[model samples]
Target: MRRIIILLLLLVIALGSAGAVWAHGVKITYTVTFSPTIAIEAAYDTGEPMANAQVIVYAPDDPKTPWLTGECDDDGRFSFSPDPSKPGTWEIQVRQAGHGEWLKIPLDEEMMQSGQGVVTEGGDEGFSTAQIVLMSACVIWGFVGTALFFQSRRPPAQEPGEAA
Candidate 1:
């Protein structure tokens, strides 16, 4: 019948047009990677990591001379172990290309007896859990809002018997 043929043609056209609508949108994937960080970091007063620094150590007896000399790694960390035999006070001096810092460590009876080295520096990890959750919520809301807006703008469907 003519009505059946017309209906099939309209259905084909509608499906073809719907395909065009689907083809109009774009799918873009953005991947973000957060790598794990190394430990033992030195920082300035502003909390910026100090990289490639010169590290020097001085014994309590020798105040004017350096006992040990080394350079900090890329992570701004200069690992060193003090002498257990020299039980007094030890000074550590860290200097970059220009900036510098000095820390005086006391090797008292209790500390020397314990034989445990203290950790003076540490690195700051990435974003907190709350921050990640907030960002994910924002992105989800943006996607949902965009989908709703597009859905509202779509053309209403035509009934089988509706006039053109």
Candidate 2:
């Protein structure tokens, strides 16, 4: 019974860690045309496009509700013109499969006047150092706990010359 539980615990840990190694980071880039249109391009870090991904755009004035929602082209590209009345930071999010990223483009009055702005990516974008440390610690802790559990169930060693 004890052996069965220990094996199951180890199996669970193996399966958990296996899935963590199979992920690819997502990347997105954007360009604001002189026409005041924002074009977005989404792709995996491996260079494969996030073809036909879902897109949600939020205007500067209203951040909660989506200002506009659409889908990317086969090339993982989408574009839309911002509202001239709403001049602040425009947020665009692109998602496909299980990957997604947020792009924050601050379009203030000056940028609007110049017809362009510096686009930046935002959000807790990727795993932080703390997060990686915590995950490694958790896996090590599980292995240690499993070892302790396994060791506790071992029978005591007998002397070679002792009678049975």
Give the runs in model 2 whose Cα sits over 4 Å from its true position: 1-23, 114-164
Segments in model 1 whose C-alpha atoms lie over 4 Å from true places: 1-40, 116-164
After TM-score superposition, what is the CA distance of residue 10 in candidate 1 from its true location, in Å?
Answer: 66
- Candidate 1 has an lDDT of 0.54
What TM-score, to 2 decimals, does candidate 1 have? 0.44
Give per-residue CA lDDT, model 2, range 1-164, as digits (tens): 56657876886686567543534678787877644778888877556878999999999888999999999999989989888767798999898876899889877776666665555333333455467557867987787688778866875345466675
| Poorest 10 consecutive residues by lDDT, candidate 2 | 120-129
Predict model 2's lDDT versus the native. 0.76
**RMSD list, candidates in order:** 18.2, 7.2
Q: Give all candidates' CA lDDT scores.
A: 0.54, 0.76
- Please tell me which predicted candidate would have the highest TM-score against the true structure: 2
Spell out the clash pairs found in candidate 1: none
Q: After superposition, how far is residue 17 of candidate 1 from its true place, in Å?
A: 51
